[model samples]
Target: MTDEISHPITMDKRVDLALAGAVVATGLLAIWMAHDFRIGKFPDPLTSRGVPYIAGGALVAGGALLAFRRLSGWRDLPGHLTVSEGTEDEAGHPASSLRAFAIMACAFVWAALLVPAGYLIATPLCLCGMMWAMRVRAPLRLIGFPVGFTLITWVIFAQMLNVLLPLGPLAPLARRLGLMY
Candidate 1:
């Protein structure tokens, strides 16, 4: 005789539901806030409110999709995977949770350093540190990801969007590096 206990629900599904609920709520709030917006005298057909409304609508639609998938049990998970009971390791040494803590610390450090060092310097350091902590094997990727992220953020904020980013004491250095004006 074989007895099997089945759990009708999964933690993954619960997480999805929670995320969906939050996103939907946030979208609704965005839409509500958007209603109060008024573009002045000579407003374009696409006003300041247009992008926010579109983004909020997209978020709402995505949240609805996630909620529907969870309710319908249409999960894109592998069937071969099985959950193992207990938390003890084979060698009896507890696995380190410090890695997660380290990542969070790195993010906090990056945020703290952002204004002083600017995003160009702080972001790449954070990305490299995170990749190292995560034990990424590809050496090229270790260098590439950080540099790519920094360049993209720089381009988007400083050039394309024309948003002023503080260069801190390195304003001249950044200008010499041809990244900032």
Candidate 2:
């Protein structure tokens, strides 16, 4: 019997791949711009460019993997089933490009405003806005998502990672919470 292949990517899949590539490329570009490209001699036995080089290489590899999986016959290689028509239960939903755009926009705005508003305020606001925009209508989740995410992010980055996020107006409150202890 002859085997047939079908398109592995829906419109949503294509959008996802493009977004991933854009993000990875942006990170790689940032690393390239911030550090010297030359691997100079170092007392620690590693150059300043070492970390960036590894990050850039990983970014490239990730983007290539996504692109290759989307555009090649790799989907059909090895164990695979023949193409078939969609059944009633297998109907696909329309891709929500608008939601994707909104989510990305929210993230950008959050990052841009983080230093100004502080992590405590900006993070919760961002999470709530993003969740609502993504059509999460449950009352509990609408409230819980932002609060939970903000607390977790604060604990992880501020407490554990030792990264100083802007405290803004919430500095007093955070101090009162005795987070430092």
Clashes of 1: 0
Which lDDT tens digits does candidate 2 get at residues 18-45? 8668857966785776485666565655
Could you tell me every candidate's TM-score relative to the true structure? 0.53, 0.59
Please give the lDDT score at residue 129 for candidate 2: 84
In candidate 2, which residue ranges exceed 4 Å CA deviation?
1-31, 34-48, 61-92, 160-162, 175-181
Candidate 2 accuracy as lDDT: 0.73
Candidate 1: segments with Cα more than 4 A from true spot? 1-18, 34-44, 68-112, 137-163, 174-181
Best by lDDT: 1
- Report the poorest 10 consecutive residues by lDDT, candidate 1: 78-87
